[model samples]
Target: MSTQVKVKNRLSSTVQSLKPSGIRRFFDLAASMEGVISLGVGEPDFVTPWRMREASISSLERGHTAYTSNAGMLPLRVEIQKYLEERFSVSYHPETEILVTVGASEAIDIALRAILDPGDEVLVVEPCYVSYEPVIRLAGGVPVFLKTTMENQFKLTPQELETHITERTKAIIFCYPNNPTGGTMTAEEWKTLLPIIEKHDLMVISDEIYAELTYGRMHDSIAALPGMKDRTILISGFSKAFAMTGWRLGYVCASPDLLAGMLKIHQYTMLCAPTMAQMAALEALRHGRSDMERMIESYRQRRNYVVDGFRHIGLTCHEPDGAFYAFPSVASTGLSSAEFAEKLLMEEKVAVVPGDVFGESGKGHIRCSYATSMEQLKKALERMERLMGRLS
Candidate 1:
């Protein structure tokens, strides 16, 4: 019998060093416990609209299981082009500038990988969606996190943005109708930051995943601004607004050259997004606006209730103008964010994402999703108030 020799571990250093997603950890804990009310995930609670679902089903029924062009189905791309022009005032040649991706997640990965070289720096504003920093590291780029504060409603100031740029800085990822904080920026705010971007010659990776869900104002895409179309990589998907998370369909729009580079990487890796999903997304663009608007209005009402509930429970919460989360400071409870989250799950059967997982700036706060039903949000708030009472 030959003896097998023990080999040295050979996982990639970057992948090995990445931490597990904190949002998923708490969510799994809640899943294991009986009767726990979970507010950990950022996903919408609604099902994909019937028209979109029927479109996907009809495509599947017609045996449309074959792969599309790596850039995705041409019809879907064309519809995307029309949607972008009509809604965001950004125009791109559907044939050359749009690369349909598996999800906005894949769009972010391929966009960064296409542009970043080893040791290149990407300024990442935080507290952000948990994936940005890790994705940057995986793409051989350094992530420089610019932490935003609650006092400023978590919007990144021009001075703070300028202070973080250096010669090595190549791009900046900005998300609005932002994750975790639900912050939205006006066109004027975008204008305030554009001069610095032009001076630095930095590429903007704008993640507008929650664009349609904003309250009190329309979303402003930096790509829509004069002279920015060539430098901005605009990313969005049908997941949030159309309630199609499991559909996993998204697209990236950029100048032809930049998109071509990303397409080369995507060709070898993803090849193409799902044909059924593309069909569904096409239907979403054409006829799903009314459904999306209804969901947005529901989210707006829930957002108000959740923020008020948090404040009533003695936690300081800023009004979230976009997205479906309420970020509330738990500093008065005298417990660290993680401690509060763990204890709340164990003792009160309520699960929330600890804010610190987003970034250091998010410490002393917790993120509660208002995406669930109103009854559940009320129940979660009552449980949180009970937990606060115990802590006191």
Candidate 2:
């Protein structure tokens, strides 16, 4: 046989060196084990409410399965506008400012792709969502991490924001009602950040997916801050609050010019979000308040239960004011967060994500999601206590 030329590598170098998400690695392992009770995933455990499901089914049955506009159905966009104005005190013109996405995941990706230039820096708070750094890298941007520790209740302070700003900095991504840590920024915190953002002329990508899950105080949006709406890309979805993860419905609200750029990318990359999911999401916006209320209440009960349990078992846990996670210090176990999670799963059959998966600053902590049933949480706590007893 004639010798053939060696094939050149076709994959981009940008994708080659990227590490797989640390959150998914642990979940994959847990899924294969029998009798494992997982507190690992950040998704809500509740099923999609019946009303929303019926809306989707009805859409499908009516043969409304054809693709909608690339920006999504106009009615859904209008619904999103109303939802934002009424609930978040933010206003967006549906025709120009809103674009529906497959999920907030896609909204994050498209927003970065639309604005990033090679070597530009995107500031990310440490112990953030697993996807942010990788997405930023994929978009040809550098990820600059700012660490927020437990001493501050995991909230990013204004001084930290000032420290990270620089000539190359293009934007900052804020995930309040944060995943992993469950930390939320107050209105005053947003007020403090506004000057720094305005002074630098940097863009803000606010991921408020957990907006409906806050306790004690209402969730506030950075986009609502003075002089912020013009420079902000606000991303949210129906998943976390409405238990609509599988539905894959989300939207972004930004300036008309920004949305135009994002829409161009979306048109080519995604075509459009699922027609039926958008329809269902419209129903959710209109009528899912009671469902959201019930879910939040249940999560609050679970959060209290888990926080108290962690304290009793000798871990220092921050009482999260929002989101469904309990980020407790595992320093007492004298192990790194990864080691602690591995040991807990192997010895106690309980699964959790190591805090370090979020960043280097998360090394001594572990994130336990309390989105599951109270019964499961109670059992997990017992198993964790037993593991602590053995280690001590």
Candidate 3:
């Protein structure tokens, strides 16, 4: 036997059994192919704006490279507090209720780990961001998926929520202006959910990362709802709104007790979010609101163009009120989402994420992100039309 065979298997069964994220497979393929117009990625194509970039560089020049407090830098936390209150009407105490994280990704992991015990159940809406389920399972919790259909514009209804609740349900992972499907819940829709949440006494890990990207109506946080401030962990970052994906700056707002628990986990796993990134995020919160507005307007234009193009080509598209994606049905082509995506990439040189990568309920649809240029969008649409014509 090789010397390596003597190594102990220290890895837990939970880590070994987790399925790899399906969204990554297509992205790997897209990266190697040339001349491909990819609508597969959810990231904005824009570079981080000039001022925020300058802040990062200036922080480096000032030699502010030391690790911050386990929670985050105080100044950045204060800025986040102000931004949340002014923009979303959500108030959080800078010192006690807020924790700056590496990204909303870290916030999700910390929130789940802090709250979930073995066998606890987490409620997640279908066609959500892919990270939610695996993170829950990694925390030794079971994920209960609640399917939201396109007929309802993919928003989870009160009836759906009530039907999925059980004694083991400990928390709900809510993502609006959702991933893979650009579904958004209205204030009225959230009102319907409030009672069920209260009756169940469930903690809500609300992921509002795309909150600023809504087209028509402003985004609202479930944490802002009456009586919810105590039970909800609101997660967001500067990625989508500020074109700051690489910055890895995200923050969470919760009750003082919850923040304390999460901070303990955060301190060990990640001592702090990067000091430079935190400075840049502070600059964004302080001076980048206008930049966010400009980006949102551009996304709105692309959203309309893509949704209309899909309809004109005889595919059914649920009108997306938020986010930079459109989920269009590919069932008429007699192909699974994976098959459609493969064929589109191989033959048409166009790339989109298969909807089923999000969950089982996302089958027969494909997610097209409009985060690329309009010129690229035109090329992708033409390629898709050709693929559809050939399939028919």
The estimated TM-scores of all candidates read 0.98, 0.98, 0.98
Q: Candidate 3: which pairs clash? A: none
- Model 1: CA > 4 A from native: none
Q: Write the per-residue lDDT of candidate 2 for residues 102-192, one digit (tens) a residue.
A: 9999999999999999999999988899899989999999999998999999888889889988899999997899987889988788898
Tell me the tens digit of each residue's lDDT in model 1 across 150-251: 899999899999999999999999789888889888888889999999999999999999988999888888899998999999999999999999999999
Task: For candidate 3, give the lDDT.
Answer: 0.92
Q: Write one digit per residue (lDDT tens) for candidate 3, span 1-392.
A: 65655667888888888888788888888889899899988899999999999999999999999999999989989988988898889999999999999999999999999999999999999988998888999999999999998888999988888998999999999789898788998777899989999999999999999999998888878888889999999999999999999989899999999999999999999999999999999899889899989999999999989999998887899989888899999998899999999999999989898999899879999999999999999989999999889888
Q: Higher-TM-score candidate among 1 and 3? A: 1
Q: How many steric overlaps does candidate 1 have? A: 0
TM-score of 1: 0.98
Residue pairs in candidate 1 whose N, alpha carbon or C atoms collide under 3 angstroms: none
Residue-level lDDT for 68 in candidate 1 = 93
Off by over 4 Å in 2: 1-5
Q: Backbone clashes in each candidate structure, one number apiece?
A: 0, 0, 0
- Compared with the true structure, all predictions reach lDDT values of 0.93, 0.93, 0.92
Cα RMSD of predicted structure 1: 0.9
